[model samples]
Each structure stands twice: as structure tokens, then as C-alpha cells.
Target: MTHDLPYNGSASLDALLDAAVDAIIISDDEGTIVQFNSAAERLFGYAAADIIGQNLTTLMPPPDRNQHGQYMSRYLNSGQPAIIGIGREVTGLHASGRTVPVHLSVGEIKSGGRERFVGILRDLSEQKKYEAAVITLESQLAHADRLVALGELTAGMAHEINQPLTAIAAFSDAGARLIDNDNDAARTELKNICGRISQQARRAGDVIARLRRLSQKGELSKSSHDLQRLVQSALQLFDHEVRRSNAAIATHFNHRTKLVPVDEIQIQQVLVNLIKNSLDALAESATEPAQVHVHVEEEDEHLYIIVEDNGPGVDPENEPHLFEPFFTTKDHGVGLGLSICRNIAVAHGGNLRYKRSERGGARFTLSLPLTYIG
Candidate 1:
């Protein structure tokens, strides 16, 4: 016998449930599928005739299928529930044998003196991909902001280092001329001047290299590279920035010989963001002798890099939304750096995240797969 829904409020609720984009399914306590909506049929590649009255376990994969009954029985008997009345992520078996990721909300319902469990399932594959894309866009913006900050600081740094370089250059030329005249005393003095010139030139070159790395924007280039070497190369690129900010740096490398295939430029971009953020955090602290540490470790199939700073740490209030686009703790920050770092990591089949460091500062960790080796 068919029973009509209650006329006023109940009818509207039924209509809303049926119209939802998510698929809805109702099953009896015996594990038989009783009601399947149009969306459920379309999503699972199954017709109502094929599913109705069939065992609900057919739509769940191996372990989940076997565990389903136990879970339902436990919930019913103990009144202690796991997924009931709560939204959860689950894998749904499709008729094509592929598993689809879904968000499910399950609730017990009573209709016409009968009890049933209704599940509302929403597909999450598309939404998850879109979220990843948005993260990438935010990361790019953060890198851009960093470049802008570096540009603003470049002129002062250049002037500060140039004076000694220019003086050394001039004095070294005069010293060389004296050496040409063949006077022993003058030649000795000239040699000292030459030594000073060589030192200063190397110093200037190091500074220029750091600036180039920070400001350079280039296309990603993929290659098989040693993880340790890549970390060192990125460190060299930011050496001057670290020193200029008075941040003491340290490193702990776990893999001296592991190799991975990745986009070198993109990975470097992520490293730069991490290092720069650490430096910025340390620079703001009132404490003396600011410090930052970078650690690289490789596990069976993943390379993990952690960059940490010793500072006041991220504001506790902002932790939940730290990786979100347009979120920043610094007054001058545009909030894109970490976001972009996350994107680059994800593109390389990894992830970037933030947490409290043992040193009491914010720590950023990058976890990327060792997808290539040789």
C-alpha cells in the first residue's frame, strides 16, 4: 500500500529532498535498498529496477560491504553511532567497477510507522579538484608579493654593498700598476689590495645571485634531481637574504642519495616561499638572535621538507584559515605565498601545510612524492 506524504510541510520537504543535486537512498534494517532517487540512479549507473529490493551491500566495496551490517547493528543496539546523522567521506562502488568519492549524510527516518535509514550522497571529486586549483592561484600571488618586497629592498642593499666593491676595484687597479713597476714593497702592498678586491667581488656576486633567485620568474623545467642537491641549490639562492635578515640557519638532511623527478623551478618556488616566510617571521620578533631551520627527509616514496622559525609564532586565531587565499598575519603580506607553495607541492603530487614548530615558531612542511628516480 502506498501512503501520501502529509499535505502541507511534509510534501514540501519531500519535494526538496527529491530535487537535491545529491543522490538519496533509503534502506531497510535488513540491508535491502528500498528507495533510490533519480540522481542516485544516474550517479551509480544503475536503474531503480536493478537496485530496489537488492542488498545495499552491492553498492559498497569489499571491506565496507562486510562492515556495513555490523556498523548498523552497533548503532542500533548501543545508541553509539559513527556515521549516522553526520556527514562523512566514503567510497561508493559504481556499476562500472570504479570507486567514486562521495560525501554522505545518513539519518534514520520513520514514515508510515516504518523505520528506515536515508543517505544523502554528494560527489566530491569535482569540488576537490576545484579547491586544489584555487590553492595554486593563491600561491602564485604570494610569490608575486615576495618579489615586490624584494624589489623594494634591493636598492638599499645594492648601495650598501657597492661602496666597498667600488673602493676595492679602484685600489686594486692602482696596486696592479705598482706591481708592474717592479718595486718589492709596492708589489707586496698591491698583493694585499688584490686579495681584498677578490673577496669583495665574490661578496657582491653572492648578493646579486640571491636577488636574481628571489626575483626570477621562469617556466617550470622538469628533470631527475637529487633531493639533497636541490635543497642546497635553493639554499644558495637565498643565502644573502638569510644573512641580511640576521636569521641563523640550520639544516638536517636525511637523504644524501635519493633521486626524484620534478619541475626544478616549481619546487624552488615553493622553497623560496618557505624560506622567505621564515625569515620574515624571525625578523619581526623582539627576541635576539633570530633563527630558522630547514630539514629534509625522504621516506620510502616521499620527500618531506620542513622549514621552521623561532619567533612569536602564528596568531592562534588564524591557524584554521592560514592556507586560505588572501589570509596573512603580516601587515605588508598579501597572503599568497603559502597558497602558491601549496599549489606547487600538490602539482608535484604532494602537499604543503603549517603547524607549530618545536622552537615555538610557525613551521611549514612540504610533503612530495618521490615519483622519479635514477
Candidate 2:
């Protein structure tokens, strides 16, 4: 790359300085502009001829404009320069009175017993806009990740709520028929039916409550929660869905109860997401006697919650990009469930990992610091 420069010719030097993309401005030791190229004109929104004889400070905003001369005098007196031979980001004042972010590089030239300074500035206005655009995009992706979880849970949640609703309807009909009879046997039956109705009402509320907790938008409030209960909560939330999907769920807790310091809801979200993915894989593969196994075990100081399914395993090729934002092999929306799950685990000082289950299916393990035993 160094050998490619046309270092021996004056024409090459002129072309390199004038035709180059970066704006170059040369000023005399007195801080008066001496040379301004075409690129400088395009960048500063000024004509070269109009700016050549003016003070270099004219191109700077008030604070820098007023202080640049002092800095130059200090450099000349002490041979200590602040910006010369140093490149950094600074503000540039355009002829249109607009401030632009710029990358600035300064160099000195000594010729014919006179001193000059050359400044190279790269405009960053568009780059700033691009950065803002990317920030907005990432914010949208985060929101989309949460919405996707809700979408996946909607089907199972519908089934969960309807089960209790159907029970309440049946009990109501039976209670109504008994009330009209007004006999001792009928009254006793009515009382039993009322209790069943209350139980179903609470069950329905539990389903809605699960959805509400997961949908809440707020910062994570972490505490020491029982790991076993947390896993059970996720299973209970998906109980009706498992039955509806013609899948079986088996849970094993070797470390029956361990208190882990983490955001309970966030960890629950990860487990639920893993379960949903497992169910989807099972459905697609049409696996006979579809099964999802969730096991909790404590190895040394770490507690592991493993969700494994008897379905199609992950493709070796897609494993690398699985956790990347918006990278999906599916025919639907952005693939962010696993990515978000991993983020949640990491934020809790834990890890979420994937591997091949013994049953030849995808296995996800979420491990946390086992803080206490209860």
C-alpha cells in the first residue's frame, strides 16, 4: 500500500491534495488562511477565493474562534501544541451558520523560513444522522422481541383461559338446575357447584395474571426466588397448551429448592420462550408422543434449568447465527427470542446455552448462581 503513492511528482502531489475527498485548509503562522481547496469549499459551504485571505478563525464557532489564536501563541512560545500533530473529533462552523461534527487532523509545514498549518477535516453530519437512525432501529427491535413473546404465548394462553371458562359455564348450568329443585340433596349439589365455580374463576385469573406479568414494561426487579417454583410457574403457564398441542411435559428437580438471586420474571420469560420453541419444533416434526422435559439440577455452586424436547434438532449451519439479532431461518419475523433470552441471563450474571439433547433435539440450559438453599 505504501509503494502505491506517486511520491516523486509535483503533479501527483497537487492532485492528491486538491482532488482528495477530505477538506484541506492551509493557514499562515499569523493564523490567516492562505490556501483552501475545492474540497474545502464543498465541505465548509464557502468558495475558496472568498475564504483564502480571511482569518482561519472565521471557519470556527465563537468559543474556538476566540481561543484558537491564544492556543497558537502558546504553541509558538512553549513549543507545546494541543491539536497540531493530533487528530480528534470537534465541531466545525459552516458558512451556512450550521454546526457540523468533524474529524480534524492538523499538520505543520516549514518552507522559505515561514511556517504554515494544514488542517484536514472530515464532515460527520450524515454519520451522526446514521447513528441516530441505528439507535432507533435497535430500540424497535427490543420492543419487537417482547411483542413476539406475547404472540407466541397467545395461543397457549387462550387455551389456558378457556379451560376454566368452560368449567365455570358447566358448573353454572348445573347449579341453576339444582337451585330450582330446592330439596336437601339439590341444595348440597348447588353448594358444591358454587365452590367449583369459584375455583375455576381463580384459575382464569391466574392465566390472565401470568400474561400481565410478562407483558409489563419496566426494569427488572430482582430478588432471591426459589428456582424450583420458578420452573414450576413456567410449566403451569404452559400446562393447558401442552395438552392442546398433543405434547407431554415432564419435570425433574434434583435440587428441589434453591434460592437464586435474579429477575424472576426475566428468567421465567426465557424458560417460557424455550418451551414455546420446543413445542413449535415438536409440532413441525410431527414427532409421535411429542415430549418436552424440563430438569433442574445443581452442579457445585451453579443451578441449571435445562429444557429439552424430542423433536428436530438445530441445524449445525444455523447455530453460529442463531443468537444474532434479526437473523432467522424461519419464514416469519425476526428471530430474537433466543437472543433476548441470552441477554436476560447475562444481565443476571448467568448464561443460557444450547446443545444437542440425548433424544436428538435442541436442548437449552439456563444456569444461575445458586445463592442459597431453602
Candidate 3:
């Protein structure tokens, strides 16, 4: 049921304007303020008496203040509107000499052979503060996820470092046994042994450096990096896990792929999570000749990093919850890996998606925009 309320003309309109929660100001065609309501007075810390005859630009900061008159002229002369009918986020000047974030919408009115513009502005300071807080919390959660993944890879990383150290020890022993020989052949063998030792030492250092990088917690910093090289680095970090699972790892990369802008450590974390999940699935299925295929390709203005494995695919019922926080299939899993991975992808203006592979296994794709501003 509906009932009509009695209209009281200008008196009712005046009451409505003052009752509004947002600031509402009316200005003439010459940009001089004509109406300033109670809400506007409270919002700008100026009484209607003081601001009634002032220019509407008094509420705007520098650039906007200086250009507003021109904008008004252009719109009036050419019928080309910028903010007259549309709403936009802009900076506003406060009476306290501070800048405030606000969303402003303007409408035009012609009355009694005169033109007037009404502006409705809502403060956005609280909204912006909330958005910033959410970003910070997400970053902290991503850092925690990285630390958990590193903990799980501790054994594999130890084995990786030990291989080079063992080789160096054997090379050193060979050099020591040949130290007493004076023949040219013995000298040549010793030189070769010393060279091998140096190579092994450098290899060990590289492993340690990779571990250090993954474990470090810092702000998200973006730079141009080769996607192919980043994928290889992630694979290297999982070398021991691959061997332990006896999984066959294969990579297909487009040589023409160009460098992309991303936070290297964060992207690597996503890659590591996908690869680790595939190997774990393969191990569980005990599939004959297990295989994990990683493919990098560029298409439709986006870059895709796909990881698929020939193992038991995810159950159809659980697919929807795979990326939800605290949702897991493994008995001892915390269920934050995929959640964090997806968050990291979205933060970069990209996304992570999952589907069944042609090889009858789970396939996960991380898609990123090639021209991402971040």
C-alpha cells in the first residue's frame, strides 16, 4: 500500500536540503554560491552566511580550484559536461587547511531564466582508511603463508645444499691425494679437481641464496622479470621433492615471451605452491610414471603459467571450496596455501583458476595481465 504525502513547495524543499546527510551546495551560472544548507555548513566548517556569496571553487584544492571556472564555461558554451552529470572521487579543501577525499556528483537546473548547479558530496576518508587496512592485513597473511611453505621445504632444501657440499668434499679429497705428484698429468688432474671444487662451492651458495630470498619477509616490490627464469628457479627449489616423488617434470615455454612486471618473491610463492600441490597429488595417487607439466604461454594480452599433473583429479563437489580459507582436503593441511596464492594473484590485477586437465588430473593456471600497471 502507498499513500501520497502533501507537498509544501519551497519550505518543504528547504527542509529536505537541510535534512540530507551529504553536503549539498547550489551555485549560479557565474560560479557564485547561491544556496548552502546546514549539512554543507557542518561539512566545510563554514556557516551559510559566510559562504553564500563565495565561489563554489572555494571548497576545492589548487588544480581543481583554478580550473573549475574554465570547466563551467566550457560546459555552458559547448554543452560538453565533465562532472555535471557524473560522479567522481576528488580531493576537497577543508576550512582547517587540510585536504579531504570526497565523492562528488553535480546536477544542473534552469529556473526563472537563470542557470544553477547543485553538487552532492560524500566524504570518503573513512572508506579509504578501511581499504588501506585491508591491504596491510592481506600482506601479513601472505607473508605467513610463505613462511609455512618454507618450513615444509626445509628437508628438500637441505638435500639440495648437501649434494653440492658432498661433491666439493670429494673433489677436495682427490686434490689432496694428488698434491705430492710432480708429473704434468698429476698437475692437470689437480687443476681439474680444484676447478670442480670451486664450481661445487658456487652451486651451494646459489641454493642458500634461493632459500634466503624465499624466507625474507618484506614489502611488495615490482620490477621486470623473465617469467621463464622465475619458473625455473621455483623448479630448482623443488628438485629434491621431485626426485623423492619420482615425478617426471617437464616445461614448455614460449621463447618469444617478454619480461613482465611483478613482485618476484610473491610470484615465486604462487609457483611453488602449485608445483608442490601437484607433486603431493602424484605421490598420493601412486600413478605409474607420474608427470608434472609446466607450460608458459602468452595469449589475449595475458600471460599464463599452467601446472598440471597426471594424478587423481579433485572431486567435483570440492572444486568450489578449493581456494577458500580454512578449506582443505589433506588430513594435516591448514588450507591457506591456495587461498593465499589466489589473493596474491588478485593483488597483482591477475587471477588463479583451476580445471581438470586432459591428462585426467588437476590443472591450475595463474593468469596475469601483460600490461598490468602494478
Evaluate all candidate structures by whole-model CA lDDT and list the values in order.
Answer: 0.76, 0.81, 0.83
Model 1 segments more than 4 A misplaced: 1-21, 110-115, 132-167, 179-374
Per-residue C-alpha lDDT of model 2 across residues 17-120, encoded as one tens digit per residue: 78879998878788887767778888899887677778989889978999999989998889887998888888889999987789999999887677788899
What TM-score goes with each of the models? Answer: 0.43, 0.43, 0.46
Q: Which pairs of residues collide in model 2? A: none
Better lDDT candidate (1, 3) = 3
Top TM-score hit: 3
TM-score for predicted model 2 compared with the true structure: 0.43
- lDDT (tens digit, per residue) of candidate 1 on 1-374: 01122212255565675687889887877667877777888778898678877877888888898999898888878988798877898889999998777899998876666557889998877876666566556656866776677567667677857877887879877876787777788878887888888888888777766654443344345688777778888786555466356778889998654777788878887887788777777777875778878998877778889998888778889988877755887786767667667766776778998899898898888997776422
lDDT of 3 by residue, 18-93 (tens): 9999998888898888777787887788888788778988999999999999999999999988987788998988
